[model samples]
Target: MASSIHSPNQQLAYQQARQHFHNQQNQKIQIFWSNQTQDIKQMNDFKNHSLPLARIKKIMKADEDVRMISAEAPIVFAKACEMFILELTLRSWIHTEENKHRTLQKNDIASAITRTDIFDFLVDIVPRDELKEDGLGIPRVAFQAGAGSSSDHLPYYYMLPHHPSPVGASGMFYTAPQPCPSLAYMHWPQLPQQEPPKTDT
Candidate 1:
C-alpha cells in the first residue's frame, strides 16, 4: 500500500511533502485568480467565452420557470463553472499525489468529493466501487446520526431551493431527512444512486 509510510521521521517527511504540495496548489490557485482578474479587466468581448455560450444558456434555462436569460448571466455562470472545475482538479491532484499515482483516476475525484464539504451534495453520486477502492467508505446519508441540525452537517448553500425541515426527533435530537425536491423536471444530473460515502475518518 502507498501508506506503507510508517516511522516518525518518515511520517514527518510525508507530512512535509503534503504541506509542500498544498503550498504549491495554493500558489497555482492564486495565479489562476490573478489571470482571471487580468482577463476580466482587459477583455472586451462578452459574446465569446471558453465555454460554449449556448450550452450555458441551455443549462440556465433548464429550470422551467426560467423563460428569459441575459447575455451577461451565461458569461457569469461559465466563469463560475470554470473555477469549480479548476478547484476540483487541483483537489483531486492532491489525492493522486497522496496515493503515489501519476495518472488521474476516478477514485481521486471521489476522494476529493468525500473530503470537501462544499461538494457534499455530490456525495450520493460517486460510484460505490470507486469510493470503496479508494478506501474511503461510501457516504450513505446526507447527514450523520448525531445531535445537530442539517446546518451542522452541511454548508449554508446546499440543495438550493429546497431547505431541510425538521423531520422529527431522534430521541432528544432532531435528525434531518434529505430535503424534499421542489421542481420535478429541474433535471439535475442524476447519477445512478449508490450508497452515500462514509463521513467518518
Candidate 2:
C-alpha cells in the first residue's frame, strides 16, 4: 500500500494557516457615530473648549457592547447624542486638575449623565452596574503613537445608568456574537482505515 507523508515545511504552513483563521474570527466589530448635520453651535463649543473628539470616539468604541445609533433613528439617536455630549463633558472635568488625577472615571459618566437628565425620560430607567469603572482609569499620559509602554491595567470604576436592571429586563439588552471556533485543525483529518486490495480481483 502506498503511504501519504507530510514534510516539516508542510506542517509549518498548516499551523500558520490555522492561526490566520483564528485571528480573522476574533476580529472586533466597529461601530461609528457621527453628527448627522453640522451643528455649528456644538462644533464651535467643542473647538473653543479644546475637547478631544478623537478620545471621545475611542471611549465609545472601546465599549464593544455599545453601538452608535443612526441620526435618522430620532429617539434613540437623540439619546445617544446626549450621552456623547455628557461623556465628553465628564471626561473634560475629570481630566481637570481639581479631580485629583482621577481622570474622567466611569462613575463620573453616570453622575454627569444623571445630573444632566440625559436618560431620565425612560420609565424605571436607572444606572446600570455593568457600565461601572473599567479599572483602567484614564491614561496617565497623553495618547500618542509610540508614546510610551502599553499598560494592561483595567479601567477605573465609574457610575453606569441603565434603564432596566438585568433581573427586571425581559430579555438581555446587549447581544454579542458567538466566538468563532478555531479552524486550524480543519487542514488535517484522520484517514479512514482501508482493507487490503481484494486478492481475488
Candidate 3:
C-alpha cells in the first residue's frame, strides 16, 4: 500500500540508503571475524542456518553409488550448503535493492546468477525470456580465469587407476566449464567508430 504512494525516485533513494546500511553492517562483521581466530564449530555456533544436517545427509545417501560417508562429511556439507545459501541470498538482495524493491523475487535470483561470474555453472538452469526479434537470448558463454582461450565451456574428466579402460579402448577427454562474466565489469558502452584517417595511398 505504501508503495503506491512513493515515487520511483523516492523508492530508489530508499533502496540506496538500505543497501548502504547493509554494506556497513557486513564490513563490521568482517572486521569482527578478522580479529578472531576461531574453530569451525565456534564459527558455526556464531552463525545460524535454517537447513537440518540430517536432511542433507539423507539427500547425499540417496544415491546408490554413495554407500558410505565419513562422520564429519555431513557437518562439512551442511556448513558449505549454509554458506552457499547465504551467498546467493546476499547477491539476490543486491539485485532486489537495485530494482528498488524490498522483496526478493525469482527474477532477482536469475539476475544475481547472470551477473556473478562464479555462478556461471548455473547458467543452464536459469531460464531467460525470449525476445521475438532476436530469436534467442544472450549467449551462455562465460570467461574462465587463467584459461588460455574462450572457445567452449567443458567439464573435467578423471581417470581412475582402479577402473582403467582397456588399452585399445578410447579414453574420454573432458572439457572445463567457464565462469560467467562478472557484471561489475560489463558496464561499458560501445565507443563511436571514428572514420579512418584520410590517407593518400
Candidate 4:
C-alpha cells in the first residue's frame, strides 16, 4: 500500500491541477448560464450588437443552399459566435495551465482541439504549422473539454460555427486560428437607420 503512494509526483500533480480546473470551471458555468438567462430576459435592444450582422449574413449566404435569411437569424448567430469564443478560450486555457503557463498560447488551443473529440471537427480549421503528430500517430497533447447546460435551444445548437481542421495522413502541424477581435467590438452601425417598411394595407 505504501508503494502505491510513492508514484511519480508529476502525474499526481497533473491530476490535482486538472481537478482544480474542473472545480473553477463549474463556478464559471453557473455564472455563464445566469448571464445568458438575464440576456434572454432583457434582449430588447436589437439595434445594438457586438458583431456585424451584415457580415454574419454574408457568411451565411455563402452556402449555395442558404437563401432568404430571416432578420432574427443573424442575431442568433451573433450570440452563437460569442458562446463559441468563450468555449474555445476555456479549452485553450486548460492546456495553458497544464504546461505551467499563465498565457494562452496558440499551441494550447491546438492541443485542446486535438484532445477534444467534439472539437475534432475543428482540426481542419487550425493551420498545419501549429500541430504535429506525436510518436503514437496522434496530436501531441492530452485533455478533455466539457460543457454543462440544460437550457440550450435547438437553433442555438445547429447555428454554432464549427470549422475544425482535419488531421491528415501527413501528420502535419495545425496552428490555432487567430481570434478576430473586430467581431466583438463591431458596435458601429454600418447601415443608415431607415423607417420601418410600409404595409400595403
| Candidate with maximal TM-score | 1
Measured with C-alpha atoms, the lDDT of residue 197 in candidate 2 is 86
Preferred candidate (lDDT higher): 2 or 3: 3
The 10-residue segment with the lowest total lDDT in model 1: 146-155
| lDDT by residue (tens digit), candidate 3, 1-201 | 355776778767866775576677467546544543353435746234467777878878765559998867887787677667767777778667656899998867776676666776666686444325455665543334433223222322223356444553457643334344354468789899999899898
Clashing pairs for predicted structure model 3, backbone only: 154-175, 154-176, 155-175
List the candidate 3 regions with Cα displacement exceeding 4 Å: 1-41, 44-49, 130-201
Span of 10 residues, lowest total lDDT, candidate 3:
148-157
Writing each residue's lDDT as its tens digit, candidate 1 over 1-201 gives 565546778767866775676678668768877987897789788776679989879867766558889878989898788878888888788768766899988877877776677787777776324223345685444444432334332323245336444553344534544333355547788688799888988
TM, every model: 0.57, 0.21, 0.46, 0.54
Q: Runs in model 2 with CA error above 4 Å? A: 1-83, 86-88, 91-98, 121-201
Residues 1-201, candidate 2: write the lDDT tens digits.
665586677767865764564344223111112232334324433232234445445545555556883433443334455656655464335333223554665544543344343334321333423432456663343233331223211222335555535453556564433433344436777799999888774
For model 4, residues 1-201, the per-residue Cα lDDT tens digits are 356643578666766766676678557757777887798788888878789999999888866558699999999999888877877787778657657898988777766676555666677666324235755555543223222122110011123237545654578755564455557677877897899999999
- Count of residue pairs whose backbone atoms collide, per candidate: 7, 22, 3, 17
